[model samples]
Target: MINTYPLLRPLLFSMDPEAAHDFSFAQLDRLERCGLLSRFIDKPLIKPVHVCGIAFRNPVGLAAGLDKDGKHIDALATLGFGFLEIGTVTPKAQSGNPKPRMFRLPEANALINRMGFNNDGVDACVERVRRSRFYQEGGVIGLNIGKNASTTLEDANQDYVMCMKAVYPVASYITANISSPNTKNLRDLQGETLLRQLLSALHQARIALSDQYGVRKPLFLKIAPDLQANDFKFIADLLLEFEIDAVIATNTTISRVDVATLPHGNEAGGLSGSPVLNSSNQAIHHLFQSLQNRVPIIGVGGIQSGNDVRQKIDAGASLVQLYTGLIYKGPQLIRDCVRVFN
Candidate 1:
């Protein structure tokens, strides 16, 4: 099939970035309902890999933040991702930062969004996931949970615990998102002392939830890319100490060095897409070395092509995910990455 996104990009680009996002998904949902989505894209290649005790059909996954509420799991699944991670969801619903929270840097193939953990909340997301064909058919679904914007840093652990317990039964894996730059001081959770406390609480909660559900779900941590050089080893030690299953190496970066001169380059939010590729890859390499293969790394950031996928794997990522790349390259990017793994 001829890739049609290039032709369609102009229309979407003309609209507001956030509006374009909603419109794109709305259209995708329509096409999926009509069962015509596959007519425009090739099926993703099957190249199975077992990571963190889950058998993935391929290494390419739709990263968190794309479908924040898990509302389009079935539609996205049809496009053929090995996994789908939805949320950054919190204990309560939020409107996110505000209008114009998301911005596009077309020149840099990047985006800057301070869309604070905006979602339909955990309950709504859980219900949506429950109704999805993907979940019912045993597809890999990771629930990435975060604290409510209103939740205080001191009370953050409770929010995370609540979300974990609620999603534990449904989540193929659960990620504690402590790295979003958009959230005020959320990254403080990454501090050594605070991180230890949070991980310990989560470890205990996971133990109980594991016994309660009669199955143990892997717990993953997502960290920011803008960390000091020595942080990786310390974080790796904690993961080993707490028996955490995996780490999503690097979230959106707070650094704007790469896009400072571009339009919307100075936006006050986490920078993602091509600008983040190098930093995130460096984070993965650091984590990989510190982890020594004991813990798996899920590489995500600025993955726009099959070669980018190879770079992540070479850097020691057992798996990789796509978000911004999808916006620029469209669904064809999924198949492209999958073929690289094959």
Candidate 2:
């Protein structure tokens, strides 16, 4: 299937990342409608495992920023993910940064996008989720929440809280995004002091909601790849202290040290692709090693095959995920990893 997908790559790769994303989703939607998505796809290994107190059919998941608005949840589930995370949705809608915000470094198998949390907001995402039948059929889905693009870092708490409240009813889990480099001052929330404050607020919200609604759901943190050892240590400590349920070990890297020779080396935004593999793994290892498996880590960077999935699990990721890998390797990548897991 990977080989077959490569046939389409020439055409898909010819377009911008954002355009290609739409094209792929549209194709997936068509496949699902025709009941032929699974024909090209292999049967997923349905071995279920418990993580974050939720059951997943497999450990491989679709990372956020791919299906940012929960638009094609059913189509995504058909691709064989144990779970699909959507959004970075905020309290209100915004147009994001600008056109040409997404760049492709095909030679490096990477993408650099300054798409500042663009989405139709939390309500719209929820409507899409509510309308999605995939969740009714045992698909695990995560909601990645964020502050509105117009909001300030100091006031990000309100935005996150609102999204949490709005999406909690439908999401299997929640990921608080504090690490998108494109949003101005957003990463600042990752600071020791700010992180503590934000996590505390979100935790309180989680507890209050759980008690009030009598429903218990996982709340994880989506951190940045740009942190130092000190930052990692502090974050791990904070997670333990705050009882943060899980951690998405990275978002993307703002640094471009590895792709220096590439023509688009100095491009802005976070770099996610083969170049991020080492840094992300190191961060995952640092967290996994320091945390000592106290919390589960979802490692998602530069993964394109079964071996990459194995490496992430070996390093300490309880579950693995991808975005760039799916683009470069195609849909067969999911079945390949599930084959390994089985």
Candidate 3:
């Protein structure tokens, strides 16, 4: 089928970034319900990959945030992703940062958003996943969890533990999201002492949850790209020490070096898309060097094409994910990246 996103792009681009996001998903859900979505998008290419003990139909998976609440899994699943990760969910629901928080930079193929961890909360997300056909059909799903905005830094571990227990049963894997710049002082968790404390708590929680559910779900950590050079090795060492299953290298960046001159360039929040590709790759490369293939790396941040996917793999990513790229390149990008693996 010929790609129609190019034709539809102009229309979506005409609306506010957040509104366009909602409108697109609303329309996607409608198309899916009417059984018309398949006609417009091709099935994802099959290139099986086994990572962290999970069998993925393809390495091209949807990153978290796009379906933060897990409400669009079935519709998104139809687009042919090998897997889908939902959430950055907290223990309680939140309205997130104020409106006009998300922005698009077409010239740089980038997006700046301070959406925060806005969602229906972990319990609601869990219930939605339980009701989704995709989950029932055994689709691989990763649930990314985080702390509530009101939670104190000292009490953050409790929030993460709460979310982990809530999602453990339904998650093929669980990611501890400590990287979003939108969340006030969230990145502080990435520091050595706090990260160790957080990981230790999560490790113990996973053990209990595994025994309770009779399944040992893998735990992945999502980190930021704005870290000091030595931080990568430090983080890698901690990953090894805690037996964390995998690491998602470099979440949205706080740096504006690349898109600093473009519109919305100075927007505070994570900067993702083409502008983030290089730094993300650098982070992946650093992690790979420190990890020495001991822990798998899921590369994400600005991947926009098949070659971009290859860059991640070549840099030592066992798997890769997409979010901002989807906004710029559409569903065809998934097929394009999957074909590369084949």
TM-score list, all predictions: 0.98, 0.97, 0.99
Pairs with steric clashes in candidate 3? none
What local lDDT score does residue 167 receive in model 2, on the 0 to 100 scale? 92
TM-score of 1: 0.98
Q: Rank by lDDT, highest first.
A: 3, 1, 2
The total of clashing pairs for model 1 equals 0
Candidate 3, residue 50: lDDT: 94
Local distance difference test, per candidate? 0.92, 0.88, 0.93
Please write out the lDDT profile of model 1 over residues 107-220, one tens digit for every residue.
999999999998989999999999998999999999999999899999999999999998987999999999999889999999999999999999999999989889999999
Q: How many residue pairs clash in each candidate?
A: 0, 0, 0
lDDT of 3 by residue, 80-130 (tens): 899999998999999899988999999999999999899999999999999
Give Cα distance to truth, residue 19, candidate 2, Å.
1.3
Residue 249 in model 2: lDDT? 73
Ranking by TM-score: 3, 1, 2
